[model samples]
Target chain A: MELWFSEDFSGGSRFGARVTQVVASHKSEFQQIDILATEVFGKMLVIDGKVQACEMDEFVYHEMLTHPALLSHPNPRKVLVAGGGDGGTVRECLKHSCVQEVTLVEIDRMVIELCQTHMPGLASRLSEDSRVRVAPDDASKIIQQARNMDVILVDSSDPVGPSEALFQPEFFQELHTALSEDGITCLQAGSPFLGPEQVVKMALDLKKFFPVVHLLTIPVPSYPGGTWCLALASKADWNPRGDSGQLIRQRFQDRGLTDQTKYLTKDMLGPCFEVPAFLMSIFRREQQAVAR
Target chain B: MELWFSEDFSGGSRFGARVTQVVASHKSEFQQIDILATEVFGKMLVIDGKVQACEMDEFVYHEMLTHPALLSHPNPRKVLVAGGGDGGTVRECLKHSCVQEVTLVEIDRMVIELCQTHMPGLASRLSEDSRVRVAPDDASKIIQQARNMDVILVDSSDPVGPSEALFQPEFFQELHTALSEDGITCLQAGSPFLGPEQVVKMALDLKKFFPVVHLLTIPVPSYPGGTWCLALASKADWNPRGDSGQLIRQRFQDRGLTDQTKYLTKDMLGPCFEVPAFLMSIFRREQQAVAR
Candidate 1:
């Protein structure tokens, strides 16, 4: 018998993978989580029926999510990762030698435990790194108390259920307060194709708190629309594209982080900021609406 | 009762869309063509069980495929579209007022007839434009006989079945012969994520004839890896990035082609040439291999 794990990625589109075996399944206080061994994506991590990360292409998503934000900041000493329980974000964060303290505020300890046990490649860094701190609590509450964060990476799921609050303006305002003077915040904005309005809203909301706001895109096939957006909002001017190739290459060399990356690189910095014309139009329209 | 259309996108992955209704299905002399009204992607056109075009995000693929090459050339008057039976590529080609003639060399007439009838938005331009000439024949043979073409867009399927010859080195050589002195050719080089070797092979093969070969990426959700690559090969020393903003804007104004495009814009010209680092590494590796 053939078993397939299918995700209904809204608008009646479904992406499915042949499941070899169910590795782990559990229902935590917040959401249901499952880890399945898939024929294509290798070990798959599913939370609330949504594919969070798969072994095959997880590096692309993780590297893109973490490195760009980390590298943008001159010295990301104290990094705070909100809502990344699987430790993939933390793993990428630890790659930087300048990152002295890595604090991961996860709502559920179950996700961290499960992933650490099942997906060691992603979650092993959680326990191995002496500088890492895994806080088993609400990110919204944690951000309120947290201060002096050099870089904040909101590695959350889609804006639904628990993550819905994370997308609100209040949450962003609190995040703004928690950040240091030169700190930059990178959050997973929804797909421009599937959820244009949502991405526009996020960009608009982010612009209110931070002076420099930019949307970078990367292809994550497991995601709803294949293309995913990352919103970089900074108190200080941090244009990723403005970084010189020599500086970026030197920084990568300094951190000893070149070999660890699969997708994120100094060369990719310029292209990542290249938003499609259609998506740019959406942002323009939103700005016009706000201006009116 | 519910119906669905699924394509196994190789590497043990499957993408399925809920079928609202079947628009058209036929077996031409070339391949099996199917048009279905999909819940997510609007109308989807499938050839040989592979998705060639879909209504919803077709503009992204079509615009990315055509514009970069067209805009790179100083003045592109004669454009040849090989294997774009659906006419989507032809529609994009017509957007540039500078394009005086567009000859579509398709292998099957049935694919055009079906798309023209069922998918009018894409195929209607074939009949509406007086400059378009549909030649229902083999692209390989047609390309060899043709000459003085400013831009040649190969909108063929995967390097399989009838479209396999289009990826051959000999075919590329013939395409080189057909082009004008400062001509450019843009072909859909498969996804770098799913089939890196195939993309590398294509890039290496194209480099044999063309002096300047560049690979650009766009997020195409319907395609195999979600992210698709387009290879731009030019005989001239034209770099898409080197084009000034004023020049691009002026060119857009000259052509009166600003409103028709949903994705391509003057601003996107620079970023399109910024390839992913992983892909750049592949090209570097291939170059080293060739050097040895």
Candidate 2:
């Protein structure tokens, strides 16, 4: 029952929490990951002592990370997902009939194995789909070699530890090169409340390389502040996922899939782009500072 | 700056911030209203020791309170506002040409005065309208005696403190007696976040009095949580307000009022009703509870 860290989403900042106990721990090659699975927010996935997702509400992140760009491409025949070893992104991509192939480039093969073992509900979907391809290799180089990917989803961790290069401009440049003319990509941007300036920096930088950039919002109960941001980049005016002629609704096909959601909503697709005013203002002020 | 209370809107009820220092304070007959307009999604409007509004962003409590019910009634020559003396409700009501008279029956008159003095930007256009009237009267009694009112806005504080009775079935009955047969009414039901139970209670009770009962949402900067809920009731079916053609696009008709607003979009009227899954579940649960 120990609280390790807390963040304020209203204004992006973190504070130390009183730690009660360490329920479970695992040391990954990159960082120490733990599964606190607190009673308050269902199961919590903590990585490097920071909350990564809550089982009860991780769908928001998984849906936003996978949906928008997947649906936007006219016909996404091939897809590449960087760093989402959890298999949630690939699971969502499998719903789209247009996606014929999906290659998940993840450096940490252990993460996938752990999820497939520890969290079967999420991992089961990956094994059920034949289109999914797992490449336990460095994503930075893997993305450079890939081509003809109509959609690319960069579902990386934060800009720290092994995920450091994922937030850099150079990695984004490679993502841009790897994407086809119609390719769309999304990145897991940090919380805009506590770390808004950083979110804005990435947003502005990404906008430079892509014609359309959108910041999607999702409420992740176990994250620093229970809020997370996803940065989406596309070469065309990409329509958000879920608005595709009720395609997801009609084709979800699985009666079980339709019932197990606590977070993903059809209406939430666009409003996630409706950034709070103060954050928008901060982004504006940041832009002003950069201009000077 | 003492941290009183802070609440995060990420998921569940985990994020809350309470400050010992009075961010904004006002003496009223009911009690002293204080505000801690945080840097969060919405400005947290704390009255006395409770949250009234949060301006960090998301949700539209302000627009829903003033627009729909106000626009529904044809040629609303006289208007009565049960609460919302802070002037935001009144400001939106003044946009309609048919609104010849408006009586703001706020129990805590000081909240209005303090709002006028401190937040002049929100209150500026409100009192200046010759058609508007400010009455520091007990709303329950005043509504019984009031007549010829085309629309009544129960823009009171939460059903806590002095405004507790405002949410009861009896109060809505009084509101029904006060308005004309075709008149409409809207009230600030607490956010589906903090008070989904209350929303269902009010919706059911209001349905007993008014023929039409519907719930709407708007984002306000001065509430406890980021999102807020507003209940809409009328003698007629609750339809979209924009179809009536009395929508307030920009704050006030004058172009001079543009610079002060933090957020309120013209196209954002109906889309505000999009509630997240967690809140919607509460509403559905409340509905089932009442049915039992």
Candidate 3:
């Protein structure tokens, strides 16, 4: 007998992986989570029937999500990760030597526990790092008290159900309030091809609170669309394209984190911000709407 | 009842689209071709059980494959499209005002005929354009006698079975001889993530014939691995990054092709060449092998 795991995107498109067996399945108060061992993608994590991450390409997502924003800030000492129950964001955050503390606020303790047990490659650092702290609470509420944060990484799921509040305008406003003067915030923006309107909506909302707002795309095979996006917002003028190569290399060297990364590099800083013409048009239309 | 079409990538990963109905299915002299009207992707062309192009994201593939090489050349008057039976490449090449003639050499006549009837949106220009000349023959044989071509776009399928000859060292050498002194040749190099060795092998082979060989990647949803790469080779010092903004805009204006394009633009030329660091490392290793 052959078993398969599939996820349907916004349209009628679907992606599937051949599964060997279901490792774990549980329904937390928030969502349904399933862990499966797959033939191609190794261990797979599915949340509410959506493939969150697979072992094959999870590094691309975790590296891209954490590195760019963290490197942009001059010194990201106090980092707050919201909704990253997988612990990949915290693992990446702990890589930086300048990072003194990493506060992970996840509403579901079950996600953290399950991931720590099943997906050790991603969640191992959560338990190993002395500087890491886990808070089982709502991310939006936690951000209210998160002051003096140098970097805030909202590694949340899609904007639906419990995670919808994370993408709201009020949450963005609270994120701005929580950040230090020169801090930066990074959040997962949906695929431009799959959910163009949703991505544009988030960018427009971020524009209200941030002086510098940039969108970057990376290829994540497990995602709905092959291409996934990230939105970085900062109080100061922080352009990812303007990232200094020498400084990035020096930081990596100082942290002893040069060989640990699989995808993130100083050379990728500029290219990641190259939004295609179709996506650029979406942003242009949003700008026109604001002008009107 | 529901119908579905699926394609498997290198690492046992698969993508499926729900089909409304199968429009056409035939076995030509070369390969099995199927055309389906998908629920979301509209008309999809499948060759040998592999999804060649879907109506939804075909523009992204055709536009990215043709425009970059054509725009980089000083004067692309004569163009050759090999194995583009669906006629999407011919359609894009016809958009350039400077392109006086487009010679499309396809191995399968049935693929063209069915596409012309079923996928009119893609193959319409092949019959309508006086500049296009269709030759139902093997691309390898046709290129042997070809000469003085400004741009040669090998819009062939994967390097397997009937299309395997397109990626041979001799085919690349013929492509080099057939090009004008300052001409450019673009061919679909397989996905770096899925078929890394295949991509590396092709890059190394092309390095021997062309003075300048560059690889660019685009998000092609229909193709295997989601992110597909194109290898562009030139005899002259034709750097896509060196393409001037004024020239691209002027060409667009003179051609009266500004609004018709969905993806290609002047800004995309430079960033497209900005390959990821992971891919750069592969090239680096190949270079080290060459050095040794």
lDDT, each prediction: 0.86, 0.66, 0.85
DockQ of every candidate: 0.61, 0.21, 0.55
- Please state the Cα-based DockQ of model 3 relative to the true two-chain complex: 0.55
Query: Candidate 2 at residue A187, lDDT?
Result: 89
- Identify the candidate with maximal lDDT: 1
What are the chain B TM-scores of all models? Answer: 0.96, 0.77, 0.96
* lDDT by residue for model 3 (A178-281), tens: 99999899999998777878898898899999998888888887787688889989898745445453465456556666667877665566667777778888
For model 1, what is the error of residue B212's alpha carbon versus the real structure, in angstroms, after optimal superposition? 1.6
Q: Using DockQ, give the best candidate's number.
A: 1
| Model 1 interface RMSD over true interface Cα atoms | 1.9
Candidate 3 docking classification: medium
Across B210-285, the per-residue lDDT of candidate 2 in tens digits comes to 8777676543333433346777788865444344323333323332223223443333434444556666776678
What residue runs in model 3 are displaced by over 4 Å at the alpha carbon? A240-260, B238-260, B286-292
Clash pairs, model 3 backbone: none
Candidate 3 TM-score for chain A: 0.96
